[model samples]
Target chain A: MAITVIPRGDVPLGQEHEFFKFVCPPTFGGGPVDAQPATIKFARKLDVMADLPLPAGVKTYNGGNSLRLWLIADPNDSSSNGATFPAKTIRTKKGDVVWVDTGFSFNTHTIHWHGIEPTPMNDGVGHTSFEVSGNFTYQFATNTAGTYIYHCHKNTVLHFIMGLYGLFVVDPPQGPKFAAANAPGAFGFDPVNFSVPIDVEAAWVPGEFDSIWNDLGHNAFMQKCDQNDPAGAGTFTQNGFLNRFRPDIVHITGVVSVPGNPITDPRVSVAAKTNQNILVRLVHAGYTVQEYTLGLDATVIGEDGHPLGVPPFDKYSFPFVIPANTPFRLTSARRYDLLLNSPNAGVFPFQVKFMDWINGTVYQTAQTTVTVV
Target chain B: MKRRDFVKVGLAGMSAVVVGSMEIPPLFRCVARAANLAFDMSFTEALVEMIDKTQVYHWLFSADAGFATTGPSLPGPTIIATYGDKITINFTNNLPQPHGFRIVGTSIGTGVIPNVNKAPANKFTLTFTAPPPGTYLYIDPFYEPVNRILGLHGAFISLPKGGNTPYGGKTTPNVQQLFNDLGSTPQFPGDPWLPPPANRSLIWLFHQVDPWFNARAQAGIFINPDTLKAKFLPRYFLISGKTGAFASDVPNISIVGNIGEPHLIRILNAGLANHSPHLHANHFYVLSKNLVVQNNVLNIDTFTVGPLDTVDWLVPMIRPPDIPGLKSTPLRQLIPHELTTVLYTLQSPLMYPMHCHMEMSQTAAGGNYPQGLITHMIFTGDVDKVPFPV
Candidate 1:
């Protein structure tokens, strides 16, 4: 059985930009310096990104500034985790549990389950509190199917600065990972359907440091010099918003670090030999308006996480652009169940594109090189 | 000491055009005669007679040349003394603002501290017994933030006790021999290649300043007292306490031409960043800094110093005194050329500078102050090396 995938691309930037001041030495609380994970128990405190018509001109190119948050997680905080829905390319059978554990200070992550509504508790941000630093489980019941996304909601700036968001899909049948575990006489009332996992969660970001360290206030000296003399008109700048969202590379593997791993790594370094082709599921997790179009530039064996009416196993190309600000449902996080016919013997390089406003710097992210012996 | 050595001219009714381009500016020169070489220094205290008294704004600079003792444009005066001699430097502040000077390292013998502007000028006395042989800088921390901008400094050269030269290396009859053994940069062409013939010396001071604005960011700060208004916003820079065409008044370093002798360049830095100071036509070796350096390989062009960093470059001998290029100048043509022709001198000898490195630091903000930064190392054409281009 294959898992069904969806792309809940249309997201709303309700109350897009926010600023919070944090004084050092804790003017209010000389309290604990390291608060493992901050809690978002109040619904009013968290902002939602969902279906909304953004300014047409504001494409991925003008991926503006980022919101910064300092998250210190306690030893246990899975309850504090937020959730998302799925991407538009997964199809599955049934009875498979897709689990996503929220980590802290590591990456920016927040989850949203767009299509499958399970009340606000499963919404992730202000709805449920899995409490980060601790572990929580989301079971993708083989009953429903849809698309969604997951990302860091609290202290988002820090998370996004590092890259932590993804897409997911769900199918009514059991996933492939669980199929091998099924026993010989396991079929009872209605045969149980399992699904497969197609891993695709990547992010591309370049000019990482310049955007992080820029401080707008420090440019005073430069400004003063320019005022006294007219020599430098536009060539130099003294001040600007510090560490504003200005990424040059938009990576696909979800992970920005080199050498992505197929299993744990959004930095996926694949582990396989020739004659083996694996399917992959992708998710969208950024604030800027995205028209995510995924074209295999190869073949189409599956759609929406499952086999098409008559699967075109032959080499082909299909491009699907995910709308901006998508959500991730828990069930879709598992994987997209697509059959791989013939695998490429060597690792092939892949990539993705993102836009930054005007001086749209850092636009392309390196793709994972799939390795097959 | 016999006479015919120096011709001191009062800077009045005399002005010369910038003789050359940045690439080849006139090189003014000066020679330090051998006799009465010891610096005449004294520590005295004075009370400001009135509130309207002239203000003392002295700019200061320092250099750290590893271990060897060298001279400084501080040519102002040497705080001379024998090893073991007790010395006291008393500073009297005639102007406003707080001031203090503390030597970097040791308390006495080794380091020195300047006068404090806070205490009435008559109150403090810097006392200490001179220590081991070495050249060190005595800094004035007085209103330190600003005093350095206005120069207030001198050199501390202690003479060797018994029968020894004030210098540390093995004894030699002249300063050149001390330079040869345990020295820094060697000699090259022109007035640079050979050592000065032990003559009376003068300082070639170099420094920087801003014509307008201070911490307050005020505009057109430097003004004329008579009109109590800024005459012109000076975007100009300076060396040896002057700027513009007027800067020519500052003396140059020169010597009687000796084709094979080397000369000294005592360079200093005041505040104002950006400096890639260079000398034209000649390449020099840096020998004695605050002290001399070991493993002295010559050829030093441009070295950097932030604000008050001091450095020394050795001018070497390139041509023999018989070269016709050097024969025309009055000292050589009007006068007779002789051996050690490198001892060239103008009516009076002086040392000009290569030029300041802070690109625009040499010019005024807009094209306002026409007299950009320039100085010359004057020498009488009679000296030995190839005659300097007219």
Candidate 2:
């Protein structure tokens, strides 16, 4: 565990207590553990560093200084401060019965839940089971309700690009209501009537940060192999430059975005009002190939966590529409959801881009804004 | 290669088989059978062989002499068609440079088809008309993606004109026989793999090989699409073109099936990274992505086919939800009653694996860990003892 650089301008620029936010703790909040089984915990937080704020002629890769671990949902308080970089947003509900726990501490992580489907020793998948080192829990039973993602399956490509993920969502048990004031909230899954009212939710996610593997450390190119050495523990190799993925830096839910500008981060912009609705969600936590582009007219309805046209999958699938200034892509860990609404009111411009998995080359783009009113 | 023997070896000169008891007068038997097809192909330059055997070179696609008798093929065959057929193709350019072709989500030849000379005057053709039904890729759109990652590309499919469901029209609702009757249950019996008048349809495609960018495009050199995102290094991860351990010992990249059938795979991420495959024991049903459809399909076990996407899934070869099921009430009271009485008396053929959670495509030349883009989904009760090469 030794690669802690932090010396480029001795880390300064916009610290904001290194982006705080922990809150939840009431043994996982929401009165009476939302009726019975809940658990939650989290607690991993190693090394850590957030800062972010780029946008004015954006140039990252260690300057927007990331290097993270997070997960801290108030793991027994100690003044909380897990320093978020995208390790919050869990929000359960639909059927509930969670567990999660996690814990860890130094090097062995796990927490998968990417599209949930529990059971494989609670499916955190560290070689199909076991990797938590100190804690584990994970139980599961959220039963469908869209948009998920929860990273850190051990060295999952440098711990999900060194920021062990977040955003698991779920909702639908008529909880987190949205559309304030004019009433109506609910959100996702409306196969004719389960909920989907919305009134602005957002989410985005969109990652990408390759500050040379964020200054390498947590077992960067792991090695240890012998099997009676004869130059063949599968032909041993060193470094191999951790499969070269040069993303200078591009954020979007963790903010940063300065390639072409416009991420006036009011939590990545959105506002709303015209005809209300909204929703977004997205996900694609970077490994490249993002695309996006929207400007309204979305509709997708759900994916990666179900809810599309509903019923026995609406005979075979439905919730389509992707009109306005189109584009659409998403790759690594893909998740969609969409929904938007805008009948008349302005602003729009979603964007994203980030490409380069190989040929589709739009290095970085980001942008944000939705406004409407 | 049994996707109907790779569509009878990439459509043997468009073998016009019509036969649904061909009397077709009863009001054009609900009309829908355009059929025309054609073929030829070529764009050669081979070398192939890499399931650790090495070799390399590439620039594929070759059915040539009016189809069948194939040769150069990394991902260069498959084609098929139906939804209003018509097609064509022809091609030629035996490699040395200029290429073309296109296809991606069709609309009558959608441009390219160029070929710029190599064999005499090279040749070209293309044509079109098979849009609607879904899945399409065809590539070699010349240089961008280095002539489709130095191996051209393939898969066109289309289907659905009673090709037993994969997309609407023809009274829809087959949903592959309702997901092969949820894995043909009587506590799971076989029968599910349907498509093309009932069975066999897999086409995975997904490729990777970056042998130093195909040995600098096999010596002609020239790359520089701005240093190809910093010297693109792939190290072999394929599917149709098979990779390490012969990518699950072939049958079109490891996918046997029997215990309650359920196959219909069709993945197609003509490589450039971003995979996320994962498919341990069961959980599959995604049904459509690039060709649209997919409204809340779900049942996932990891899905994220990126670069030039196109997923389709169905996999439900049933049974393995951590086994344990003879009759266990209340989700077996949440497991662990001595491991659900020892996994409820185990059974069937099993196998599993289906790798690529993007952990560096499960490694290959950069340390052969599971030999890149791994495979295997057997489940066999006896898919002819799971070996297919004929």
Candidate 3:
């Protein structure tokens, strides 16, 4: 079993610690390396300083959205190769041991692996399990082959929006069974053998941030909990804790060129030869509902880490064809792995659409594209 | 994808095509086949004070939905019907503000309206096809965030057509099961693949209210939606409108049930926050969620019920009498692991404290902890004093 130890932190990690203390100032139960960091971030910082330079093609919203994430450092790699936000794409074979060290410099955070059935102790929910303050090692064996989500469990309403998340993909071991199932020779079935496919692959982690929630330290908004209408709008008391969750910017793969700037939003790229299959893993870490439409015909091979139509789970899982125009809806923290077969060389965009939860209305679309030549 | 486009694409067609691949058992399986039944109901506005004396200006359903009398109750009573029954509720809104109702589950009817006040003081005759027996929710869809919190929701249950037994198949006909009979063993002795049968079924419609909103609305003050969003902290957590908001009243807390009979605890979280309900002595088996039976019922000491989620568990009082159908020896002898029996069968009836694991929910409005959302499962000295109302 391969043991992969991944450390979670942010780029210019040192600056994030400074910023966290500055906004949450020690007075309001926030400071450098405070014990109860998750619940004690700055109350309200309408304007925050961007101590770190913006990544190429990335912009900020609301005095700059401050939460920059990175999953860096492979303990196995002695070299200086380390963590970066939209943390390095985690790829592993089934049965490999993944030892995730959640060493957050500021605030408390727990890593909840969406759709992965880890023990309750390993299930990183703040209230359910102990939240990691400084550093804690979470060890688990990847048993299922599918695209899964990983995000901070502390103060889910806020922490998830603050951009502490990534995707975890476990690949099934290749074998005779896998080869037969994904045989390209099967007529009209250029199946991208997900079990050990000889094809290109890309992982799309679709998420958004509420500019306001990310700008202020968690403590600032939490400070307003159960208080009178500070906003003075007066409809009723504000539930700062209730997750009003109005995000201004949406991006893919943790590369937000600018908050509220979806125009230059990034899309994952993959190349495959004509008639070759490309595997696309669509995963969600954001809090709202997302619907995705594949530009080309694709077969859904797995969902939530289970092989479609496999025994026992066949009662639930089944391989369904996504007709060219049909869309697959994903609630918060859902994953779908699809194999896209390209008959012609061109760009195939997966239109990831967002909706307003209060009213079932499609509001926006974020695109992730794959090009085959 | 646009909403209209999504609807056009095949919301209804998708389910039909998917079900063709597999055979899902009929929702509720009962032995006693019954004919379709219908009922009429209405909503009336009332200023009722909760257990903590916090007055809420809310809409309540009158006990008799029989077309004439209107007396609103806290958690409008449960609407019980048999599978394949047709429930037609004539919900007349008598409040100053607009109100409407919708029954969720099954495709019997389209009972949703975007706005209840589109027609001033309207009366909506909603229809529902009740099949696939399970617990369902009927809430005020309009301003649900506001109206539901103001106490405008109720429970709806559809029993299998003719069977007193839930999920009837393997066991004897006298045994009434809640869902399908997966069949049971001496170890389970109740529902197959589930816990022992409960003699009494209790519904705990969990809800919470922000006292500040209740006070503001009661004073006839206008509340701004944005401001309301800013101060939305729910302090008063309740189970069926009990659990006083003060620690001193803990002794007189509402009773969950008495010992000797396994209690089917139906827990529904209508509030915004997730509730981790922790039972004291006896761990329960989560039999079903919403109304869908699980492949294998899970045994848990504390489980979370998220907002708008429903969970049903059998809080077994003891090792039930091993019956003929369980296919195993009667569990007359206690094993070392059977601690649930030792604690419950103590010489004197005991009160086991059960509360929310979130900790904050058990507090008073002013941040006093251990005041709200806490109760006890009472074990009576004599089995005759079974606490629940049949």
Candidate 4:
């Protein structure tokens, strides 16, 4: 039976809407992920892997503001021939629309989305319009299709550093082949609802911030003066998807000292337990397009947020495209989710490279890992 | 004629014309112009002397004493007055250790004051006739650690200077001059209506610690004793007070944690040592430093809390969950209570620093005292914002 991959969506809410309930079943002590079945089940609790809660709060959007995108899934992704799997990929259109409901306090943001052409009002920018803080909805649609980035276009001292940025992808030239009567039976599906991004931007990798000399321009920020984050991961572990609510400060005065912050953010451990084989809708949100190598050797079953014909991430030059300043973000909370199936446990690492044709290195964060069962 | 003859003629003609009339700037003229703009903004620390070493202490008055670094060292007397009456302090010292002060308020009016090892005792005592209504501090070069420590640091008690007048900044000036007044004539300054760290009609002392470099380095460098051994290594980590400020509390001084009520603790690191001093819960702000305090500092849960750092915290602020609608389960409030307060503000509950900044300093003979290297901005009664309902 062909399988599928995407973020388990619509994390159901409790009647009382307790803050803790909405939070990822906290790492270790966190209680539960109230998401619907798909979002709630923790990658099949197995003893081989430690059970961890997923940091949570799915993307919410307001009405009037809407998002449109293609949802593609993969049955057998190439990156996972080595990984145990019952996985699938979800794909989006050349121009997809996602919405943002300024329904909550943290939702107040200006959308700096990449890859598509959005109507001025739908596009998330303060200069163009007002901020969608509470129940106000903002809509956006992507026209420039390629891997891109999105973030709150607000006056952020460091919003992205506060873990605000997300990667988005558009339609790749090649995509998944949905089952048709000509060949297969109606395929079963995995319950991931949203398009999740799995861009391996070192910031989420499980490794200590050993420094990436490859990102030449940033070498100065990584000089030998050390804080032994490697010898011990301490309470801080760089891994998995970040939190949609809180933000982790990434740099201070240009220094790349991971764990060099409010010490340990509980989000990492939280994200570890809740979600699984979720779509890592990859996008290029940085100034330069990156050569994001999942340092953990993840198989690429999908490209540009879409499942490919045969997933090996075989499309080398099919660059994850993000135009310089295009506002290609979601209108109705629509996001491009990547398809993944990581049966392997523990934090899987990844290295991000800003492949700027200028013969250089990719700036990186402490290696982040996505713990899976 | 040769072309050479023509060239010589043109040159001679141009030279004669120029010499007779044209007045263009010369290279040296440009150099001189630049030189005129070049200003070597020098500074210096205060220096006290016994002349005979027989005098118990030499009194300093701001009016007579030049408390700036770019001019004289022991230039004059103390600028003295009552607690509430405002005053101006002017100084000059063309040496090093740019002078600074450690008073409280808006971080303005910080000129070159001295922080020298040989500071005048009482730093040229400006005995306030009385104490101000609130806690106040005054030092030279108001922004750093070295200048605020050692002998340069002093306290100001602005009590009812005139008929027990309370703190209304608008009260009439006091007539009584506390201890020493350099003179009745005002020193070099203007009005006190300006912002903080600057007060007209105030006292100024110099907290000078010679070898300012050591204290300055402590704030920046991390000493890994594991990597460097004593006597065998050249990197001396000792700053201000020569030795043991971090290892030992100020000798003979017993600092109290919490009195009867919520206490307000003000820790100033105007010395040379980079101190990762932690207190029990209570967020703090680095009020003034670098001679000017910027508004850059907001509510800080825990900071490096280093040299030249000034933190003012309220001890009695309530722990949350004490009010209605807010979750106040003991476990829930534990972390914030522990990390955010003065007692174990940084631990996991009340959340104190699991590991202090400079992580290395958190240890003594390889073990943490938790209390020794730690402090508390303790609260006493009626915790202010406890969010849980009865």
The TM-scores, one per candidate, come to 0.34, 0.32, 0.56, 0.26
Fnat for the candidates in order: 0.00, 0.14, 0.00, 0.00
Best by TM-score: 3
**Ranking 1 against 4 by TM-score, winner:** 1
Q: Output the worst ten-in-a-row residue range by lDDT, candidate 2 chain B.
A: B22-31
TM-score winner between 1 and 3, please give it: 3
Candidate 3: where is the Cα deviation over 4 Å? A1-81, A175-198, A218-242, A257-267, A360-363, B1-56, B62-75, B84-136, B139-151, B162-390
For candidate 1, lDDT tens digit of each residue in A1-373?
2211111111011101100000000001011111113211111111123221222222223353332222222223244433211111223333332333333333223343322222111223320122232223222222233233343322222332233343444443344332211112222212233222333322222112123322211111121212222222232222322213344323343333222222234345444554543444433333221222222222222332323221111011122222222321111122222233234465444343343321223344334544556
Which number leads on lDDT? 2
TM-score of 2: 0.32
What fraction of the real A-B contacts shows up in model 4?
0.00
Candidate 3 interface RMS: 20.6
| TM-score ranking from best candidate downward | 3, 1, 2, 4
Candidate 3 docking DockQ: 0.02
* Superposed model 4: Cα runs more than 4 Å off: A1-373, B1-262, B277-280, B285-297, B304-306, B309-311, B314-316, B320-356, B364-368, B377-381, B384-390
Chain B TM-score list for all models: 0.54, 0.37, 0.67, 0.32
Residues B1-390, model 2: lDDT tens digits: 222232232222123233222211110111122488777777777776564445678787776544434455667767766777787777777655777778776544434443445445677787767878877777876566777887788887777765445774632354554554653445344564566644556667788877887888778788875575456678767776664343543344556654456677788877667677867556577767888765445555677787788888877665453322222332223343312221111111233456766566655555434446766665434322332221
Clashing pairs in 2: A308-B296
